[model samples]
Target: MTDTPKPWRIKSARTIYNNKWVMLREYETVAPTGADASYGLVHIHNLALGVLPIDDDGHTILIGQQRFPFGRYSWELPEGGGPQELPPLEGAQRELSEEAGLKAAHWLPLIADVHLSNSITDERAFAFIAWGLSADHSFAKDSSEELTVRRVPFAEALKMAVSGEITDGFSLVMLLKADHLLRTGALPPELAKRMLAGS
Candidate 1:
């Protein structure tokens, strides 16, 4: 007689807490790959957005914000995460307009991937690259935000990221990826020059 595979099942799933920005969940499930033992897991799923704004002058827009958790200020790209169902490019557009009042005439998908770490919560960050950026007359910001937007040379952004000045994981990843794109001639000439100059 052949042995049948046992289906993994969730013993219990519960939400420990719920808030505006995140939810905490506790789960108990039978081990899927091993014996009949059960296991418990805790996960916090947070939604986040990231943007890469490349100006015609070859510069990129960034922001400097004070993170209360870290008790220090860090350089970051325009980004946010929430429950809104906007598409990735649309999210980038919203973040750009809200944070910097800049809009892109051209946009493309940079990456969409999971950001999972053993030490931190399980989440995913979506990144987009935008071009032909122009500043609008006004920016509508959320009440909780205290952001300072700045246009910096793309190369300098990479240097700061490598030096740990831009420790925000999403920003670091986006900048590094942008740099790779620039080096590979994947980015426009104006943006490429600006990225190389590190303005």
Candidate 2:
């Protein structure tokens, strides 16, 4: 049997800053081949919770907002991460309330460690599924955020993802994963009907 490859062992790790949203670390590592390397690391604060907020009738709530970096509004979920790591369910509930003013009756941990393949930073996003929401709540957005929350069926969200309208990597991963869960009976039964309703 072959041994699995292990990452170079870290000789030391130093915290550069413990910020509100991310913790920066500097690490020194000694490689198997006797090479030494240093890397600056970012530990994201929140678990990167995304809520596929669903209603009894199986509709999802989506948000379209201007991402200053992207220079346009893109469809996405209510998500954020920082030092305040609420339980996944509470995080999902809070994001739903803050972004869409909705509260899900049920929440499930879907998956974790979804990477943004194109980023220079090595990061992961954790996703969840929220079900049995009553209705949209009035959003309380950040001063910099200009968003318009939109409600759509899950089926349409899937199409948007397929067509590239949903460009955020984390959001795409979560919704698609939620779909997979549905197929395998991992998704909440009450939440399953909203999957990308064909327009």
Best by lDDT: 1
lDDT of 2: 0.72
Query: Model 1 shows how many backbone clashes?
Result: 2
Kindly report which residue pairs in candidate 2 clash with one another.
45-82, 46-82, 101-137, 154-195, 154-196, 155-195, 155-196, 155-197, 156-196
**Runs off by more than 4 Å, candidate 2:** 12-18, 82-85, 113-124, 136-139, 194-199
CA RMSD (A), model 1: 4.3
TM-score of 2: 0.80
Best by TM-score: 1
Alpha-carbon shift of residue 151 in model 1 (angstroms): 1.9
The alpha-carbon deviation from the true structure for residue 147 of candidate 1, after best TM-score superposition, in angstroms, is 1.2
Please give each candidate's TM-score: 0.81, 0.80
Candidate 1: tens digits of C-alpha lDDT, residues 1-199: 5988766677788887777665666666666575454343335444578888877666788898888888998789989874446566666777888988888887767778657453336666788888778876355798877988888777777788999878888888898888788779997676567556655
In model 1, the worst 10-residue window by lDDT is: 37-46
RMSD of 2: 3.1
